[model samples]
Each structure stands twice: as C-alpha cells, then as structure tokens.
Target chain A: MPIRVKLDERMREKGMSLTELADRVGLTLANLSILKTGKAKAVRFSTLEAICKALECKPGDLLDFDEE
Target chain B: MKQSSLSLRVLKLVLTVCWWGSVIMAVLVPLALVYAASSSGNPKSDWEFSYTGYASGIDTSSLSAVDRDGREGRVEFNEGTWVQVFYPIETSAGRVKLVLLIAVVSGVVLAFFLVFIKQLKDILDTVSEGDPFVEVNAGRVRLIGVLLIVGTFGQALLRLVVSGYADSSLRTTGFQLDGNFEMNFMQLIAGVSVLVLSEVFRLGTKMREEQELTV
Candidate 1:
C-alpha cells in the first residue's frame, strides 16, 4: 500500500521547504520526512490537521491512495 | 544502560566455581586412588592365603632324611609363604568420618548459595519489572554469607583432621595441604565477595530510589 503524499508539490507551490513546514507544524524533520515519503503507518489526526494548516491545503491535496 | 546487579554476578561466579571444583575433585580423587592401588602389584594374589596348621603337625618319620656335617636330620614339610594382606587400618575410619564431614559441609554451603542466588534473582526480576523502589532484603544475603563461611571453614578443618590421621597411620600417605587450603580460602573469599557485592547492590538500589523520588 502506498499513500501518495503531494507534499513536494504543495511545498513547491507555496515556496516552502520541509524544514520550514516542520517548524510550522511543531514536528521534527524526521517525522515530516516519513510522512512525505509515505513511510508512516498512519498519521495522527492532530498531526494531519497541523500539516494541512501549515501547508495551507486540504487533506485531499496532501494525500492520495494508490495500490502498491 | 542497564547493567546486571553486583550480587547476581558474584552469585553466578561462585556457583560456577563450586560446580567446576566439584567436578575436578570427583575426577581426580578416583584417579589418585586407582593409581595408588595399581602401583602396589596384584593385591588379590598376594593377600589371599589363609594360615591353617603349624609345621609341628607334619610327620617326620615318613619324610626323606638329609644329613649335613655331623648331624642327621629328617626333612619335614616346608611350605611357609609370605603374603601381604591389605586391611582397613584405624586411620581409614577417621578419613571416612572426615569425608562425611566434608560432604555435609559442602551440602550446607551449596544450599546457602542456592538460596542466595534465588533471592538475588528475585530482586533482579523485580528491578527489571520497573519497580526500582521495591525493598530488598539485605539480611538474607548476610545470612547466606555467614552460612557459607561457616561451612567452608568446617570443610577445611575436616580436611586438616583427615590429613593428620593419614599422616599417623599410612607411612607413605602423600597429603597436599596447599590444595585444600587454597580451596577453603577461595570459598571464604567468594562468600565475603558476595556479602560486599550485596552491600553495593543495596546502595545502588537506594540511589535509584532517590533518583526516582527527585524525578
């Protein structure tokens, strides 16, 4: 299973880096990297909300379900 | 950074030494006895004769006569033979007693060590279960140490008595005082080491408790 994360596209469109997003969301770079790479088993709702708010995007804009 | 407790480590060391020492003795004592028995020739053939009748019962009238010098004499039966009979001397009884004493003392020492090891393992288990504040009984360790010391000393004394008896009865009894003394000394040292390590473990437990309280 793969969770297609559009973090790279969102960050590019917003002219922000992963470090900047991690700082905004009060998360570590490693955790943010896991989420961006779709390596996370599941993201907490609070963490997802924080990421969406920091990215100024909807959850649908950040996540996509793809069979792997 | 969790390390094993000092008492537990010492207990393991003592048990290992005790087990190995017993194994070596069990092998060596029988070998020594076999070597001693084999070197003295065939004891069965040399010591199986029984004295029956004396030479006075022999009939001299029917025997052939042989004369030498100016005297004539009749030859009687001459079947005298020298045999060496090995018997359990008085000293062997004392040695048996000493061996019994050593066995009893070793049993007591082993029992004490077992109990101490079990108690130490229990304490370690409790610590591993995240109960650092659990009360440890130092008295148990102390009691076991005392018992071990007493048992070891008793074994040493018994060995000394056996050696003394052997010296008096068996003329060629080769007794090595060094080995027995060293074993006894090591046993004493191990007991004392356990006691000291238990004290150190108690201190470590107290420090851990204090840290937890401050946290």
Candidate 2:
C-alpha cells in the first residue's frame, strides 16, 4: 500500500485513456483500472515492461514509494 | 470453469437433512421428556438414570453361566470391572431431576450438532461454488473446530455433574456410581486438525487475493 501508483499522471502525460493503454498493453480494462486506482497488490515485471513500452515511459515514472 | 459436482451436491443434501434432523431433535427431545414425565401416573419406577458402576466384593463365586452345550457352570472373574446399572428414580423430585438432566444433555448435544452441521454446510457451499478460498470459510472452519473441542469437554463435565448428583441422591449399599467421564482424544484431535485447516484456508485466501489483485 505504501508503493503508490502514479498511473493517472503518467497516462495523462501520455495523452492516452485507460482503454487505449489496456488495448496497447494487452491487459483488461478492469486490471488497468485496478492499477490506476492504486488497488493492485502487485505489478508483474512483464506487465510493467509492456505498460512501459506502450506508454514510452520508465516503470519509475508510473510508480512511487511513499513512506508512511 | 465452475463445473458443478454431483458428489458435492449429494453431500449438501445429506448435510441439509442432518441440519433439519438436528433442528427437529432440538425441538422434540425436551418435549418428549416432558410428555413422558406427565403421562406416566407413577413415573417414579419408569424413569431411570443409566450409569456404569464398579462393584466390589466377591459376587463372582455365586455367579453361574450357561454354555452352548446346555451345561451350567460357575463363572470366575479376574477383575471387577464396570457394571451397567439403571438406577430407578423413586421420588417425584428425582424424576423431575432426571427429566431436566436429559433435557439439558440433549439440548447441549443438539445445539452443538446443529451449529457444527450449519458451519460444515456453509463451507461445503463455498466449495461447491468453486470459491473455497474465501476468508469467511476459514472462520467457519475455526468455529467448528472450537465447537468440537468445547463440546467434547463440556459433555464430559455435564456427565460428571449428573453423576455427582446421582451419587449424592442414590443411597444404594452395594453400588457406587461411575460417571464414565473420559477425555475424548479423537474429538480433540479432530478439532485441532480443523483449526490447522483453518489456518491453511487463511493462507489460501491471502494468496488468492494477492493473485487476483496482481496486475
């Protein structure tokens, strides 16, 4: 939970919608929604690679560690 | 792929029947006792507490046995073991006590059995639905395990109390009432096993949730 997902900010910067990113990354919209909403328990490396490649960004750009 | 299992369905049916049966018994047992007590005009000799007792002294010398050869012979006993005695309730108060004892014992047993069956049915329902990793199922299993352990010990204590009550009231010269109270290792083991299983379920639920939420 401390690892915050900045997917919304990254997606906004890329000018892409969740459905578009899901289609590009080969992920379901529901799963993308979970990541965007910071509810995902884990992000697989392959999924991260696909999302990063689709969005043309690093994993660090979409993820942040917030110390509680 | 949530394919329905026929065996699970049959087991659910059996559990349903058992649940209803326990429910019926919970309602009927005390009623039956009350009816028996009320209907018998002279209930003193009719009602009795059946208990096992140890008899002392040398009564085996006079004991006779009939073999299959139709020859009667004296039987020798090595050790004076337990003897089943149906001690009659001679007084109205005693009969009332006996009825109350029966009612309480049956109530406890049926109550535990009902809850146990209900919990089991709930777990089975989850299993049948192909979602046995739910967290609630773990709680249910834990509850059943605790119930089993508690019920076993509680029944033993109740038996002891009833036997003590009988011992205090029944003033027979030769018979000493034995409560037949013993620790049930099997039920305890079963309860502990279920508790362990509940832990396993907890872990499974956690793992499942983690897997589901992983993106």
Candidate 3:
C-alpha cells in the first residue's frame, strides 16, 4: 500500500518539468502527475522502463518501498 | 465532479417523492371508496342469489344482495333477520377486490423504491470514500427485478378487474370503477424502465469491478 515514487527532486536535478518528462516518455500528463504525487496503486514494468529511459535514471533511483 | 453526486441526490429525491405519492394513493383510494359507499342514499333491496356450479359449497345465501344498479341491498335470511349490506351500485365485489390488490401492489412498489434508493446511496457512499474494490449485493438487484415483474402483472390484473366491474350492471352512486388503458400502459412503461435501470446498475457495478482488476 505504501510505495514511494521519487520524482520531484530528480526532475529538478535533471532540469526537467513533469510535462517534459511525460512528453519524452510518451505518457499522459495525468499519469505522470499520478506517479509524481505517489497516488498510483502500482506502476507497470514497461512504464518504469519508459520513465527510466526518459529520465536517464535506474529504477532504484525512482522507486522505494515504504512501511505501510 | 460534483455534478454526478448532485444528479444522484436528485434521483434519490425523485424516488422518495414517487414512493410517498404511491403510498398516499394506496391509502386514499380505499378511503374514497368507503366515502362514496356511505354517501349514496339509495335504499337497499333484497334479491335471490346462487353461485354457478364452479364455486360449490360457497354460501350464496350468506352473500348480501345489492340492487340491479349495484347499490347496497337489504336481504332477509331464513332466520327472519334483515341486514343491510353496503354495496356499490355500479361495481361488483370482483372490482373491490382489484382495488385492494392495487393498493397492495403500490405498497410493494413503494417498498422496492425505498430499498433501491438505499442501496444506491450505499454504492455512492462507498465510491465517494474511494473504496475501489467495493462489492455490491446481487440480491438487492434481483429483488428490484422481481418487484418490477410483479408490478407489471399486478397492473394487468387490476385492469382486468376494473374492466369486469365496468361491464357489470351494478351501480353505486358516486362510485365508478373504470378501466384506464393509459394507466396500464404507464405501469408497463414503469416496469420496463425499472428493469432497464437495474440492468444499467448491474453493468456499472461489473465495470467497476473490472476496472479494479485491471488497475
């Protein structure tokens, strides 16, 4: 139930807006917003791959497990 | 965002109004019949009565007689006691039975309306609370379906009863039992609407479940 989506800090370091990342990854702004706000129930592996490819980061840098 | 909730609220209000309206009709119709029966000034008359062979053992002697117009009649039994029976001149017992049947059917419809609104409220509440995996009780839906079916058939039976009374020679002052073809049509439409709405709810619930699974 508790999954961490680390996005804002990485986006800032990469000098990217959510819109820019979503555009690069071919995802919707709504979906990117959901990921950024940690509101997604689960993220697909394909989506994770796309996000990583667009952000030039490993999955480890993007996702973390949190205590529920 | 709020529009859907507002629409549901409106629907709940409309359903409540319909439920109470039907209930009022259910009560008032019988009262009207009683009032009409009492206000008539025609004197009662006694007449010989016999049941057809189909209804053997029925005490036709005990059945009170009414005027040819269907007004209340006084009958003297073999015991030499005279009793006054209040019967409508234009309506038969079969017609009165149908009115009572309509009252019962209306009450049942009101009950079903209440239950459907309550379940709808529950579903809305669950959805509002963000419970994506909510399970709807299928039994409630089935109950609505059954009520609709019953109401349709009950309306048809009421129509038949009214037609029988209309064709009878009995006449009671201020009391008329007329068959309204429009009412029967409305009843049929209502039944179909309820059935369609129930199916829509079932489909919506199924889609929500599938969405949860896909998500």
Docking class of 2: high
Rank ordering of all candidates by DockQ, starting from the highest? 2, 3, 1
Identify the runs in model 2 with alpha carbons over 4 angstroms from their true place.
B1-3, B40-45, B49-59, B64-84, B163-181
lDDT of 1 by residue, A7-65 (tens): 89999999999999999999888888877776666667788798889888998998888
The DockQ leader among the candidates is 2
Q: TM-score of model 1 relative to the true fold?
A: 0.33
lDDT of 3 by residue, B33-126 (tens): 5654444333452222211111112234456867889997654433211122243334345444544555666567666666656655555555
In angstroms, the error of model 1 at B212 is 4.5
Q: Write the per-residue lDDT of candidate 2 for residues A13-51, one digit (tens) a residue.
A: 989999999999999999999999999999999999999
Clashes of 2: 0
Clashing pairs in 2: none
**Which numbered prediction scores highest in TM-score against the true structure?**
2
TM-score of chain B of each: 0.39, 0.77, 0.40
The lDDT of each candidate is 0.60, 0.81, 0.60
RMSD of each predicted structure: 22.7, 3.3, 14.0
> How many pairs of residues in model 1 come into backbone collision?
0
